[model samples]
Structure formats: structure tokens, C-alpha cells
Target: MPAPPPSRVTIAFCTFNGAEHLEDQLASYLAQTYENWDLWVSDDGSTDNTRAILHAFAQAHGHTRDIRIIDGPRKGVAANFLSLLCHPDFPRTPCALSDQDDVWLQDKLALGMAEIHGEQPCLYGAQSVHTISDLTSVGRSVGAAPLALKTISFGNALVQNVVSGHSSLLNLAALDLVREAGVPQDIQSHDWWLYLLMTGAGSRVVVSEREVLFYRQHSANAMGAHQGLRASMLRAMRVFGTTYGAWIASNTAALRRVDTLLTPQARDTLTALENAPKKFAALKRLGVLQRYGIARQNRFGTAILWLAVLLGRC
Candidate 1:
């Protein structure tokens, strides 16, 4: 008998006033080696010609494959993405999260599909090539480091996000898991939220060192490349300021809303973190974090996490 047809993948793409680089991204999708995929775009109040471009692309490709363009929630990036992920019409298939400004490599879908398999919920992420606005290559993204399985725990996910949304693929099981969690109102970062939810719920996360897309660095990027000295200083400021603390608080509350979905260990860890000793008792606060295994991926980040806790910033 002939082999079963490849499972169709759904691209959950979000857009907002991305007229400049949107064409390149759309073209890249069309050029994918794995052609059995549908496009679902949620345009979040684009004031430019973005909607026009999307309509034209849909008209061109709609006959050959499934293509949809829907209005977004107009809240922010995270809200827009969540709307797509939790959409009632979202297909029960592997879903790829996409950004409006990035250009994908030809084999992105093929490589992701090859790595993600089985009945368990799985999230797939790969390295990306960082480039300038003109698509000139700068270097590989910082996510190129080899991922350690031990570092994928819920504790680490609390402080660090190992998955890049643009390069992420969620299996069918993962899609169901997200739907079960439902759409959250205030998510600081959709990718980070996914990492936390998936890890906490005891799902598989596969990361690849292979570069999958061109992560365009431009002024209009929401959370652009977090590299270089300037970016480092900005991050430091956030860590010490109320911003980082706010993000942690928001994410913690969001997880709490779906507390029952997490594994026993993860639920315990979350509770412990919530009940951690006051920051005024620096040593005790740090001890609590250590005891619960709440950590970041790298030594520097872990150190920063401890400092943040001590400073009442976490």
C-alpha cells in the first residue's frame, strides 16, 4: 500500500502593520519544502497595507491550500497569538507559530515535522539566523547553545524561555493542551508562557541547533534581538527595575489559573515559589529559590535571578 499522506501543518501567523517585511515572510512560506500546510493569519488592526497584502496572498494560494485571515484582539502581540492558538476553528494538527517580519528557511516545516512525533504533547524550537533589516546576515541567534534536558523543568521555565515562537512547532497534543489551558488575558510573552505551561504540564520540548529562519532585526520589532552591550544594559535595567518583577507576577498568576493542569511536582514548585520567604530576608529568599530548583538556563541568568529575588524584583 502507498504510504499515508503527510499530516497537514497549520501556520498560526500574527500580523500588525507589517507592510515592509510582510511580503518576504509570506513568500518564504510559499517556498517551503513541505508544502502540505495551511495559513491562518490574525491581523491585529493594521493601519497600513498589511491587510491588502494578506488578502492578495490568500487569493493567490487559497485554491491550492487552506488560507484564512481573521481580525485580532488589538491588545498586543501575546493576545493576538493566543487568539489564534485558542481559536475555535484552529485545526487539530501540528501548529507553527510565526511572526510577521521574519523570513523562513525553505526546509523549516520539513525539519520541524521530522523532529516532532508520537502521541505526547511536544514543542519544537530551533536556532535562527539573525539578520539586518535588508536581510543581510549578522550571525546566528543566541539560542544556538545546546539545550540540556534537565534545564527544561518548570522551575527553569519560570525565569527563562527556551523556545522562540517564530521557530516553534507544537504537535497536535500540544494544541489540545493549549486549548485546555484557554486564552489568558495578560501574557507578557506568548512564547515564554508556552514554555512554562508545556514544561509544567509534563510535555516534551525538542530544541534543534539547526537554523530555521532569518530573524530580522529592525527598529519596528516588538522584542528585537537581545544581543550586544546596549541590549545587555537594557536587560539589566529591567532586572533591577519593576518591569521584570511585574512580568514574573503576571506569569505566576496566569499559571495559577490553570494550576490543576500542571504535574504534581510542578504544582508543588509553583506553590513553594509563591510562598517563598520575603525578599527582605535575602538569604532566606535565595534559599527558597534554591530549594525549589527555580533557575535560569545559563549561569549568568541564574545569578541574575538570584539577584532579582534578593532585590524583590522577581
Candidate 2:
């Protein structure tokens, strides 16, 4: 009797000026325990040796796996990722996103596929060990807590993203779900948008407690880790200032554009949030949030979020 062939996983990797640490990340992929995969890269106008390194890797390893590289939209990180995911040439398969500077654990792909192998739309996210430029472990990221299935709701995704894109995998059904919604306009974080889209469409979001990658934090990180007191203060400031409000507006507008794809409860929650600012009294606005069960992961953050609502920052 012949054993079944292993599932082929598609790696959707995006790069900008990541030549500094790109080689190490690519090496990690080569060392993966799961061998059945192909690489599809989108380079967003790299001014450095990023393109050269990518081409070199493809030339060297193209025989082992199918490697295809393309030009990106050059808008920004969010746009690059969305464009890669929606590219017609990208295969509809079990897919994982890759950051050019991060090193994945040997089992990153195997574990992700094991969890997301399902008939329905499913998104899988895992935690990571934070590392400095030299790959020395600082610690696990702050709020790297395992996500509970109950907490994975559209209401919570409205204000927070628990799914880390670099550590995420989307099954075929989830990929179809994303393509059905099409690429959104003006999204701040691709991961947050994925969280919103998955939960809104009533899909399953499964999380792994295991840390599956080394999330490298460097001076050139497009988005830094939210792991320290300084980072926490910066996040609070964003919540209190216009930045958080702008992000919320972007996400909500994108959701509105595809409301038909969302579940009935998700649509109701979106409407409630859109109308929250119109309520005259702060208490009434807070009541609307409380009624919809919208909250951040922790009480302190949730308190700050409520205060942001009072100040018209959300």
C-alpha cells in the first residue's frame, strides 16, 4: 500500500529592504522539518541587496521547491501583503506568511498545518520568542498569552488583534474567504484585518500556545514588538491620540465595504460601533460597548480603550 502524499504548503513571503537579516530567515526556511512547500515572494522595491539575495536563493534552491518572485505594489507593508495574498498566480492552498527577518522553528509549518487542516474556513496563529538583532532571546512577547476560543469574537477583533500575521496560517477555505472579500483599502495592519475578516465571516480562529518563531526586533523593523514599558506607553498614547482612531476608522470602513460577508451578529456589532460616537453622553457610549461585549484583552487596556471612546479617540 502507498501512503498519501503530504499536503503542499504555500509560503507567502514579502520583502522590502531586508537584506541585512534576510539570509538568516531564508536559512531557517530551508531547515524546516516540513519539506513539502513552495515559496512565492513579492519584493516591494528594495533599494538594497534584498532582490539579489532573493534571486540567489531561488537560483540555488529552485530545484528543491517551486520558487517564484514578483514585484510588489510599493504602497506599504500592508499593501504588499494584501497584494501577494490576492495575486492571481498565488495558489489556493494551506498558506503561511513569512517575515523576512524572523527565524521559524523547525515545526512551524508542520504544527500550523496540523491545526488548520479542516474543511471549513480556519485561521491559525501562534506565539513567538522575541529576539534582538543577533537572535539572542530577550523573552516571550508581552501579552503572548494563549488565545481562548471564546475570546476570538468579532467584537474583540473590532478593538484588538490577537492573531500575529508572521505566526499565522490560513487553510484553503480561509484563503477563499479572503479572496471573496477582495483586497481592502487603507488597512493599518494586515494581521488585524485578517482577524476582523475571519471572525466577521464566522470562521474558526485557532491559536497555539507554543512559540513557533523567533520574532526579530531590530532598528529596521517595520513594526516593533509591543513588549516593554516604553512600547506600552506608546500604544496608550496612540489610543489616546488620533492614530488609534484612524486605524479603527480604516478597519470599520473596510468591513462596511464587505458587510454581506459578515455574520448577522458581526454586522450588528459593526453598526453599534459606528454609531457609538453619536451618543451624547459618555455613559451611553460605554453602554453600547458593554452591550456588544467589545473589549481589549486586559482590564487596564480595556479601561484605556473606554477612556479613548470618551475622548473620541476610538
Best by lDDT: 2
Tens-place lDDT digits, model 1, residues 103-198: 999999999999889999999988888898888888776642465334677888887777888899999999899999988877788998898999
Worst 10 residues of 1 by lDDT: 141-150
Which 10 residues in a row give candidate 2 its minimum summed lDDT?
Answer: 141-150
Instruction: Tell me the tens digit of each residue's lDDT in model 2 across 1-314.
Output: 89998899999999999999999989989999988999999999999999999999999999889899999998888889888999998998889999998999999999999999778899998888989889899877556467433477888899888888999999999998888888898999898999999999999998778889998877666254757777667778878998888898899999999999999999999999888763357777788889999888777778899998887666
Off by over 4 Å in 2: 147-150, 222-224
Each candidate: RMSD to true structure?
1.6, 1.6
Q: Relative to the unseen true structure, what is the C-alpha lDDT of residue 309 in candidate 1, on a scale of 0 to 100?
A: 77
lDDT of each: 0.86, 0.88
